[model samples]
Target: MLSFNSVSSRVLQTLNSTFNFTATRHACKITSIHAITSMKTQPNQVNHSVELGNRRKCLLDRPGLFGIKRGMITWFNDNGRQFPATVIEIDSVEVIKHKTEQEFGYTSVMVGAVDKLKNVNNLKLFEQAGVSPKHKLGEFRVRSETGLVPVGAELKADMFAVGQMVDIKGITKGKGFAGVMKRHGFKGLAATHGVSKAHRKQGATGGNQDPGRVLPGKKMAGRMGGRSSTEMNLEVLHADGDAGILVVKGCIPGPNKAYVKITDSVKLYGKSIESIERD
Candidate 1:
């Protein structure tokens, strides 16, 4: 017969071995299950990332929309910093036609905004697109055929997200026949020493007689503004799809009710959504 102490010791050893074996088996099962689940999810995560990247690339490559200038307002960012923002109204923007690379040597889309009487030249195109006549017509070039928008698809201001950078092209306010001092920011001649009524005139355009007559591109008093201008890297502050309003940071070139073309920033083409979120 074994002593009580020895018998108890033997039983405890057996129980400990059994518990260890059970725990080890359960831990292994859990680890294997976790690994299998991770394996199943890994491909999905990769595909999701690829999809986001493609969408971002497509957004960058796609054509832009047309809008009307709606004046400016003060805006505050998340950091409580105030900025002057320009409001743009997008209405009745639709794809008018598509230019194919095979036929046009490059890919682009013709878009129009603001309904108007159908012009004879665009009657056929508008009828085919099933859209009303547009008053403001603009063409935007795309990187590839995939960026072409479907004809007659209406676009809204919501296409631009807050925090996205954009470039606005428009006709600036006209200042008819401005002097050099106002147009080109030229400093007038001294008002004290010996300056007379000619103080406001631009002093001596070209050299004495080297190249003779004023240079072809000489800067002098002339018409100011009213020309096509582009304001680059303007940040989108807000976008309302239903209302078709886009608020952008800083001033845009144009007067109220003037049509403007809004496009993604060419300078920030390399930036992606991830980088924007990081910033």
Candidate 2:
């Protein structure tokens, strides 16, 4: 069995030669945010992804729930087998607003991604949030009574440690206008004799009308994907503070360079942020 050091060394070396990168274990730096980036940035954008695989399990205490973030993958375990990991880039998340119980009705912090937009409308919204012109914004509520991150404070990658379990939330790729078979996993009508145009259709909307018409939420499909998704308890493979990169142990939702909301695993440990090591 290979040790963690061996796995890290082999993977990084293979990655350096293939991508012409100067990355090491401690200094695994990536300039490009695209997953599976080329030595030079490519002209045509491709949705390259990182693949995850099974690893030896180790227990850990959950970290503080950080708010919404955006990230992309930079490496892969296989071409795409078993576990598909994501190398989430920490793009300088800064707090913009905070809602206290006294002020509003709940306690939560609103954070925005590093400002990259210059549009007037966007800047106006950013001003209200108390941050500079940011591209995207998201909010987070603490699970239990705890200290709040002051508005304008920046969120770092080191808030999470290697081996901790995290929950990643993001939008899945849009499939757009799908049938019931693909969207809701409904077994289609008979695909043989007598089946004309009802192959991939959801049969029987309403049989008898004791309650009348097609029920409100019947198993039929129009649109698919393009919605929020969450993958729980993805193990943190490697976490670097200086480089602001995180490699997790399983697949995350959405296309490359999609916005993601990462937090402490609610499924793993539903606790307060008491052991958060703030910088």
RMSD of each: 18.5, 29.6
Q: How many residue pairs clash in each candidate?
A: 0, 3
The segments of candidate 1 whose C-alpha lies over 4 angstroms from its true place after superposition are: 1-60, 117-121, 270-279
Model 2 Cα lDDT, one tens digit per residue, 191-212: 8989998898888888586666
Please report, in order, the local distance difference test score of every candidate based on alpha carbons.
Answer: 0.82, 0.68
Per-residue C-alpha lDDT of model 1 across residues 1-279, encoded as one tens digit per residue:
899978866765676676432234323222344344343344345644543544354335788889999899999877999979998999999999998856865667999999986344657778998999888887887766778899989999999888999999999999899999999999989888878889898899877779767889888999999999999999998999899999999999989999999999978863444555677
Find the candidate with the highest lDDT and give its number. Answer: 1
Q: In model 2, where do residues sit more than 4 Å from their true spots?
A: 1-82, 120-131, 271-279
TM-score (all chains, Cα) for each model: 0.73, 0.64
* Ten contiguous residues with the weakest lDDT in model 2: 50-59
